[model samples]
Target: MSARLPENPAPLTQALDACRHRDPEGFHRLRQAVAPAMLATALHFVQDVRQSEDVVHDTLLLAWLNAGRFAADDLPPGSWLFTILGSRLHSQLEALAGRPPSAPRAVPTGLQGQALWTLAHGLEPRPPSASLGDRLTESLLARLAAPQLPRTPTGELVHPPLYDARLRRKMLTSRLAYQAKEGFKRRLGRPLEEWAFRRWLAQRSVGQWLEAQGLPRRSVEAALGDRLDLEVNPGRLVRCMSYPDAFPDRTERRKASNLFLWSGDWDLPHHSLADSSRTRFIQDLWTHRLEPSRSETFRRLEQQREQGRPLRSHHKGMLLDSRERILEYLRLYLLYMENMACFGFDKHEGKDRLGVTIDRHGRIIKTNKGLHRLAMAQVLGLSEITVRVRSVHRQWWQRHAGDAKGRDALERVAQALPECVPA
Candidate 1:
């Protein structure tokens, strides 16, 4: 395949032109436009991290100086850049390797931008991969999982007004309808939706409804089309959300939970939601300073168990509610304290990993998704833990990778993954 990706980036000539005249923003734009592709080609072709980086840096530095002589139409800037890059590579080992890597002196943030590109410049989706669950389980068994993806914080993330009458009203209506449908489906024993609608009203919606009668709603769709993103976190990711968001009661509930995805503006003061009893109690129990029996979550489960309530709900089905799955949970908490914590976070990506959502700026927000392990991480102070990026805001995809196509988007995500996690 050619060094350039099949598609050309937005005109690099203009940005280069701006550079010729010494314009700062133009320089930034030009680098953003071509740096990833240039670096990808160089790195993949050379298979040397240090050498590839130097080649890209030297090529860009040379390009900056020759911005005036550069013209766009004669040859794509990507092609020209790669040409220079290849030339640079010939000398990198002998001439450039020992020389200090070229530091971007134009802007202080130059280093930051390069760091982001290195992190986001990923090959997450070339050879097609297994589900996030499978990969995580494999890693866990091998005992080689360390996950931390540090998120780039937006200007200021402020929570929007929590009470919106119209939205809440609509949400209420949707919930009521869902419960009614579920009630009917449960009563009918879910023979693919139900026959009442089919016989009485043979519509497409009814037919579709019939197809989805008893199964729990589909929850795992990070949508690499059919593939899931690799759980590569080079930075620390504090588990973001709670159980309710992680395990919504209804399908609509999950969709409506998009409230956190909204831009609350970085300037406004943001306060994390008060830690739920689940988080607080677990931290308390983690110390063994307090008896696990004193935990309200544990006590509630004990009482519920005595009353014949299931200790772990949904014992054998999709989207199990283990809302009451507390007894064994206590034992597992001890396992970690006693140095037997083998099940790294990713192993639970199928359900309980710290689930989070990214906003337009790729800021991971708490959605109450994975509290149990999140609490453990807090107590353990583990530097790295795998996360289930359950969903990303539409704007996040658009902003990170325009067009947001599957391959590009996932790569962009992988590139960004390093920034979100700790080094």
Candidate 2:
């Protein structure tokens, strides 16, 4: 109770610093001090006391989880806390308004497009093989295609690998002997035999095998994490391999299929791997029509508009595929090109790729990820690009508040703190 209460950011940051070290008493004291202000801010937005309390509670929990990430030294405690409080409250508003929470918008820099295509199409491990039945059936067909197999009525190999019991028996016997020699065992401590091992392997997935082998799951996840990174529909099927070096490190045989040609211009100024929505504000500003060398058609349109005449919508904008474009009034001038990487993909933290979230009315709510890339695509006259969608049906707000420790302590803090009036 005698702890120096934070009247401003310095004392507040000190209290947060103490909380980072697992000082429960220090955290509680600070929570008690800040709760009133947070609640007052929440009440200003959502007048209901119950909803205000919920907002304050969630804010405190976020402060707890991400306290280390907050830059207490540079910002005053009130400013920092209020920012988080405002963000959380805004997300709540979005949810109530039937919109998904806002994700960070980024402009697609040249670096982002180049990096994704290069990395995505870069050397990577192949996906694991098909299921036991499919693998065996395919292998059998290949074997039957060999010269030794009997011919069908039409002179083709009989049922191509026609379910040879002798071959099957030989393979099983060989596998059993190898397992016996290697001293592999079942979970029950019994020696692993061919039949049991085969059954177990068939039942277990590749992820499970990695866990058993003590391999980091990140090995495959890192390469195949974007399995659906380029697709539009959320339910679209993903093929983990198909491109060269698709799954470089692994020997698996899976490949991606049905990569839709969302854009015809492969070498455009920008290409998006995810989906994005376009707002009228962005469209009217012609953010995408921006280029170092202004095009004549756009210049004419600008002039026509300045003269109080309506400009036609059919004016040719930036060239879609060519890096070369002529500026208006200058016959030989080329526009300067700016190619920068905007986002990068990573396994642990969700990759920062170009994406767009759409609202129910088919409007672009926001660019979920790559703002830079979207601008480039727009400038290039590209209409459609692949991107991830954050639907209103899916809520990404912090729903639950506690970690390993129960919510009892946090609940007590909320209860003991006094409610402060809004400024």
Candidate 3:
């Protein structure tokens, strides 16, 4: 007799909860539900039915072992299962093919015959339909059945070449920056600075260059063309038509192009540029320099105004309307700086230093240090100076401020600072 299963409203959620609570039945149900999808995803990576199946089995075991760690709000059991399957399959594929598993190559329509011929020599099961899942299964089966294709001779599977993670991260960062800038431009009705936009383009260009060198033609086209919206046709034509003499030496050209495209400028003395510099520039651009501008912030505020609704107003008027609000803006700036520091901006100079000192014309009158302490006090919602000194800075400023408290302390501090007139 078929076993009866529990009828829960959200079986997946219930299974996850049960697994967290150490219920064997819930764990089994979750495993069974996710196994097929994991198998399918694994096959897509490994391209060998037996190995793919093995990978799925191993992945399921691992998932079950780690089931207690799974959160209901995180990915569903199927997706989590797939992640494990994909990672294991990648390792297997790397071993068998002697290279990393990259994005799948697009088989040409005419090459279907070749693929079918390849499968015929292997143990791939032919499914009734050519659905994506079926195709994946077929590919895996074919690879398993015929591990040694005559053309390959050594019985190795054809795999795409591996790229360093740094390249991938750089590419992704540039793409995100471009999208963010475009979104900002749309909202603000003003284009981002040309230099900034070009820098983004350059990083994308470097990624394309690496992909062109490493990826197969179809894979290269798919990755650069479809995802990044870059036209590889023009790049291909340029590569084909240009004579060796017209370009710098191969090594120089690659280095220059990588830097120029990724760094967004060819101004550096090409011969003198070091690999560290190139890497540093890419790292800096990726982390610190590629953020949405203040213009975006103001534009968003304006948009809210146009919609006949607005953000909360203080007694002075709109939150962004007065000079005091500049302090609030600077607080966000500090947060941005902190984010940059966390994301590999430590190497670059000036990134560590806070900008926007309160100045009259060109002469510096005030600094962010005092403002930050004040802002932190406000954020902590302190009302009394004695309370703030005790709780916030721990009486560090008591000797200077005397017994002053609250707004009076702030006023006294500001008055004490030198007020240099505008130049």
Candidate 4:
């Protein structure tokens, strides 16, 4: 409503405070937090790109006007803006539907995802999928046998607008170099308690840049969040996020953000942990319960055999050349995972704990990382296993992370961890 500069890089809630007094700079900062996603999802529903921009502009105005009524604790500020944006898009679409037919706008429609092998720059609309089974099935099977998801093998994959993996790798190495110079002993054992704390200091900013660009930074955040060592119950993880292979072809997973609500029912079996082949493979490996075909990994590998992707960490020098060798490697991997579940997760693996996210309602949503271990944890009915926070819902952040930053934020999040995670 008005204008003033924040004296510091205040948290979103504090920025909202600046807005209460009509600081245009605060409104601009607020726009930076939520507008990218508001625009992204608006494009998904509003067919005309120009019209979508109009919808976003109107929705932000509504958000701005209502900023005083916004409650960071009751709901994430981003989610609040999204609720308004969704309504605006609905009304816009309705108005268009009521209008008489007219010439199509020459401006380009937007693209949500892209292909890996081609120059084509858009997502192929998903063909109609088979409708899901009972809601009970989604709930029961989610914690059961869902596949490692973000099913990039076949999802609408996307990346940060211009980032590639080689570039990302260089970025990480650069950060670690700075940390090393800061006197953090990368080689030494840190008390488990300090893991997340240290991460808060060094990398809380890991995916903040992506929020302005309107992407789900969860992938990178999970990989790089406050790397807390949390021993959570296997049952606590009742759901997970699902998307098709949409991680940047260059980066390992999706772009990161804690702002928008991506999807809640991603925990459903149809979404993850229930791929027929993966389910069959789990049955074959863990229980001999299914007379399944060969592991899907092998079949997938058969096609990619020409690609010659090396089996990472295989003891033998390898290529996708030998089935017998691959089988042995799979068996060893199974055993290694088993030992971690049965004997207690590695005491010496340092911060390589299972990565997880917390939803606004506090559900443990498993990420694309650590699918094998997650499955094992569920199947074995292990009571507890260590994990780290990758990213959390903005509502989760407001309640737990609050307005705190640095060690204060770390301490707040750490105290809230086991308590906020569902029992």
Candidate 5:
């Protein structure tokens, strides 16, 4: 028997009818309504958020394009949608299993029964064979290189990179004391819509913003191309190529990025090898105490607490987020003995370095974890920090067309794409 939908199917039915009538607005509305649930389902099976997004994106597009073929006798609307999602899911699984060995895979491999973190150097670009052309990136870089580029945060062109040499020469001849300052309005602490709006106005470029504030200029394109000769010295701060959606406040994002402090204000050691050995016993406890192995560990622990017996300190709270869950099986760097942290590709909608969809005008998406640590590294002027990067593309509705009400929602979801795309 076909599984029934949890709610009334009228909304989906209406969206389908609208799509049959060739209404773009209707199709978009439908996508917004169902994409999240569909994506959640996809994630359960695929385990990779990016792959799951692909399945949802392809499924929605296919469903929209072919909705006209459905007849009165067709299966329930929910079942039909599931059928498409399932077909896409199958294809994704097959693609993973049959993938060529030469191709880079982010599969978490077990090492000595522990999950090992994958290390990705920033300067390495994807091989040409796997290239997805990105014209949006080209456009953004060209804009940044323009002679009229903004030098100050408030759009003041006091001393641009092009004129830095001139300023240096003048300083030698005369006393030149110039303080570049921009009373940047704090855009954070506002509502989500307002935060996203100002971010949109900022063009979502953390690197450019850093340059405007007189920091060292780093070409985003160069970093993405892996052409920059950046030395990987521990604790060095690298400018961000992607804006983080995890943080919606522009002021907060800017503070986090400029200071390289994405994680938190605390100076706790994170995901380092020095602490890995100490945590090994804890790791073993977690591993062997898997639901089956320590089937009654939680129960016994609770009972001991009830009896007034002290529980082991290892009895930490439950883990959360996609990164933490994946770390249970794969050996990766854990943040503060809880979260898994790595430098995956910038999966932010406008910030994806891969440029799978070319419409994003080259904006930096936000980072999920380690924002504070990254910002702090930059603030401390370190030479290098190793980051593991995963390539990412925008999710579905990449090419939506509509008024502000419709398009803004699409873009907002796009920014939140990283939350759904775990590496």
Candidate 6:
């Protein structure tokens, strides 16, 4: 009799065929294949390493349970797994305490300091015949010629008052005087004073001016809408008026001042209700000694098994906390870049601010974004105008290329841009 053929095929082949036939992989090959990207996606969404890992674990379980529904053609094994990971991650993110999806910050990649140092310094060196002194001198001169650093006034640096008392008093006094000069007695049938009416008029005037300046009407309305609402306080306007020296144009300073006073910290109520003091305190703590503290924490955790101590709750908590901080840092960095692209400067004018000059036409004339975009385009041998045109014609590309390639192409274009643009 012929030897009986082995009944089962190789696991990988069996698994692939099973996947094609929509059979669950009892061997967990799918989990192994997709775990790294899933983990990265989870980490990005949750901004906490432990939580992200937990999310990955849950994602694997879900993928296993729903494996039969996965179509080999529609999602490919990798993307199907990532879809589940992303869904779970979004759910977890929505449930996080004291954090909004719109939070301005981002998390860091948590790259090791030594690794980064080595990678940065490992670039190709100049030829031996090149003048090292000339290069060094040029570098020094470039650094010296960089834009002036912003100086925070002594009183403005730490715990600055929301609005300077003197400024507030002056603004109130001016409004009262203006009302008297206008002879605007209480024309309203209600018992409101002339000064209140004048304040409303001032707000209306500013709103109209903003509309005329081509500011998005919705944004202007949203920023100033409740000016007439008695319950809403316009303290931010006072703060803006107090910081005239911070603004470049006198008219913009005045408009911003009025807008701030009228708006009175539009974000305050949302933050207060959410009770984000803990989050802010944690952020400040992380920002203070991020590198050293992160290194020590990583080292301690790495040696935990050999130290005869199992991972304690506190250690786990610290790791999660640090991961969140790092994630937040990266998110913030991305946002800073996005804001610089849109607004010509960093919103907060922090140390990371790129002080590039922009032209009146919203063209980035001399800013880092312009330079980077130009340098990237040149490196890729793409015209600067072509890059901009491609961005504008993205919808057409998407229509023709379908979703995946279109997205991939767009991302590639973005990555290649900085190389073409001048830095």
Best model number under TM-score: 4
Choose 2 or 5, whichever is better by lDDT: 5
Question: Model 5: per-residue lDDT, tens digit, 1-423?
Answer: 112223666777777878777666656666656565565566666677655665565566556655775453666565566555654554355446643211122223321001110111111212211111122122223323543532332223321212333233443223222222211222322233244434433546453343233221122222223421122332322223333433457876565433211333212222332233223333333333213124243344445545665232111212212222223322211111111111122222111222211113222222334453333233223344433222222222233312322225334533443323111
How accurate locally is residue 350 in candidate 6, as Cα lDDT from 0 to 100?
A: 40
Q: Each model's C-alpha lDDT?
A: 0.43, 0.35, 0.34, 0.46, 0.36, 0.33
The TM-score that candidate 2 achieves is 0.30
Off by over 4 Å in 1: 1-252, 256-274, 289-291, 294-329, 336-353, 403-410, 421-423
Please name the candidate that would achieve the greatest lDDT relative to the true structure.
Answer: 4
Candidate 5: segments with Cα more than 4 A from true spot: 1-6, 99-423
Better of 3 and 4 by TM-score: 4
Sliding window of 10 residues with minimal summed lDDT for model 5: 111-120
Task: Give the number of colliding residue pairs in candidate 5.
Answer: 33
Cα lDDT tens digits for candidate 3, 185-252: 55652322233333323444443343223212222222233221111111011001111332346764
Q: What lDDT tens digits, residue by residue, belong to model 4 across residues 1-423?
A: 112212233456766776676666666666655454555565566656566665555555555445677776776554445555554554455445553111111112222111111111132322111221132123223322222212122121212211223333444454456567444433442332245434445545533333223223333344335544566776556555554532323333333423232333333332345443343454445542111125565566555545676343211112334554455445444544334432344433422356666766766666666666666655545566677666565566557766675556545765776665642
Rank candidates by lDDT, best first. Answer: 4, 1, 5, 2, 3, 6
Clashing residue pairs in candidate 3 are 49-140, 123-145, 202-261, 202-262, 385-406
lDDT of 4: 0.46
User: In order, what is each prediction's RMSD in angstroms?
Assistant: 22.4, 29.3, 28.4, 25.7, 23.5, 23.6
By the TM-score metric, which is better: model 3 or model 5?
A: 5
For each candidate in turn, the TM-score is 0.35, 0.30, 0.23, 0.38, 0.24, 0.21
1-423: candidate 2 lDDT, tens digit per residue: 222224455667776776566455545655656665555555555666655564555555556545665575666655555555554565344434544222332322321322322232322322212342243233333433544543322223322222233333444454456556445433332322233333333444442342233222222223234442332322221111112232233332121111111111111122222332232222322332224234444455456545665332111112121122122212111111111111112112223455433222222222325443444344333323455432210111011112311223223322322221101
lDDT of 2 at 71: 72
> Across residues 252-333, which tens digit of lDDT does each residue of candidate 6 receive?
5445422211222211221120123322332332232223234433345336534655242221121212433333333333
Worst 10 residues of 4 by lDDT: 112-121
